[model samples]
Target: MRYWLLGALMVTAGASANTSLFNLLNTGDRVNPVAMMERVETDHPGYIADFELDVQDGELRYEFDVINADENTLTELTFRATDGTLILQRNSKLEADDHDELEAVKLLDRKQLRFSELVRMASEQHEGKLMGAQLEHDLGISYLEFKMVDENGKRKHAFDIQKLKPLPMLQWER
Candidate 1:
């Protein structure tokens, strides 16, 4: 009976070890730019931007820089490494105000925390005021933006923390 239980435990552990979120969510090894570009062009038509693919944090990621004909930043997009799914997309103009606020917040003296940690703290501290939160990265700066709605939903405050530095990107072998 003891041997059977031990065997069952080992089998279960092994099975679970192979079924991580990364494995379940990621279908492919990494995305190739040529392939991704082809797909992007076909899907988005004129909106697609020039992109580069590289390994970051042991995962494959695609970094795209889209500039309009007027030489203004339009959007910056990043795709996941394991799969080509879009992880982040930002419109430069739309984020301008948020970016400025984040920069100001970065100068504050609060203890640094991870994105998840900050969100947890904000949710706990603000409770009913907290709506949603997301980590925003722009021009190599990382910040957290929290959206809070008042009880009447008449007032909204988008709080930002600009000082929390982003984790360094992992170096990949060429």
Candidate 2:
């Protein structure tokens, strides 16, 4: 009887622990929010707000807000790549005069190439000097960014490719 009670208690504790949001966020095999944001910035070179992640009903989601150059707040929703599903979403407004502009150029359009294609092109263009490349799609637009080390080994170059449209085809003029 004592063994049975102990086992029952353990099971109950495990169930409750799994349901706890903080515990799940800390223990899950997910990327750290700060590190993820840094990577996003390194890859895209844009301003981002802090975010939180949670698992709900077996799906992982993320929520955050981004401040545009114009200081407008744009809510961001991200789902976990481990399982393709809606993880979480955040919607909020920015205060007036909070905008900051960034330099991101549009390279290709949605109808011209797929996400994978952009990554491939960027990677191939950089070739042996290429360090890494990543692709991000937000607000129905895709951005292909890459990083590479300079010849002097002291500087790193990050490229941001955005504005992929369909009408007049635009190709990367390497």
Candidate 3:
């Protein structure tokens, strides 16, 4: 009963959609997201292509997807929020079939907007608890993708990497 309430609060109490995640997760006392991200980068040689900080079933966690171009591999790592301990790691080789995605990730270096800027721009007209973000592309057009949740459930907010304008929202399920 307590867990359910805690989960719901964590879900809905994100201080609106445009706010920074440093304020959304309220992790100042429990975890240091920057340090956690640094730890992930140090242990794995790659750039974080995707990231999320969320509470699921009452457990706080950090999820990161690292893309290593040299090794042509994509790695997913989850860390416990309380102590920044590695909880899980999944690695998969980026095959010839994944060339498009690999190239899209490489294009992130050309983005003119910062992550926080993209988040605020994506949420300016929409409202949802910001969950995570990723660098993605469709039909050769690259964008920064964000995951958000509200009473209506999870939805994606994307911004064009070149224009820095909000893209259409796409509804998705758990």
Best model number under TM-score: 3
- Model 1 misplaced regions, further than 4 Å: 1-28, 45-49, 70-73, 94-174
**Model 3 misplacement above 4 A:** 1-29, 32-43, 53-57, 110-128, 150-153, 168-174
Superposed by TM-score, candidate 3 places the C-alpha of residue 5 at a distance from the truth, in angstroms, of 24
Higher-ranked by TM-score: 2 or 3: 3
TM-score preference between candidates 1 and 3, better one? 3
1 or 3, greater by lDDT? 3
What C-alpha lDDT values do all the predictions have? 0.45, 0.41, 0.68
Candidate 2 regions with alpha-carbon error over 4 angstroms: 1-19, 70-75, 81-174
* Residue 135 miss distance in model 1 (angstroms): 29
Order of all candidates by lDDT, from best down to worst? 3, 1, 2
Q: What is the lDDT of residue 63 in candidate 1?
A: 67
lDDT for model 3, please: 0.68
**15-91 per-residue lDDT for model 2 (tens digits):** 56434533444455765444454444444323443233445576655444343434444546565734434455555
* The best candidate in terms of lDDT: 3
Q: Is candidate 1 or candidate 2 better by TM-score?
A: 2
Model 1 per-residue lDDT tens digits across residues 1-174: 999999999977755633432242234555544455455545441233234444566665766544332333456777884567988887665245444334333333234333334544444444233323444445555444454333223122233445333232421111
Q: Give the lDDT of residue 159 in candidate 1.
A: 31
lDDT of 3 by residue, 1-174 (tens): 999999888766643333444344553455655566667766787667777976667677889888887888989899888888888899999777656556656665455333444555666676655578777778767777777666555567677766767766543454
lDDT of 1 at 29: 57
**TM-score of each candidate?**
0.32, 0.33, 0.60
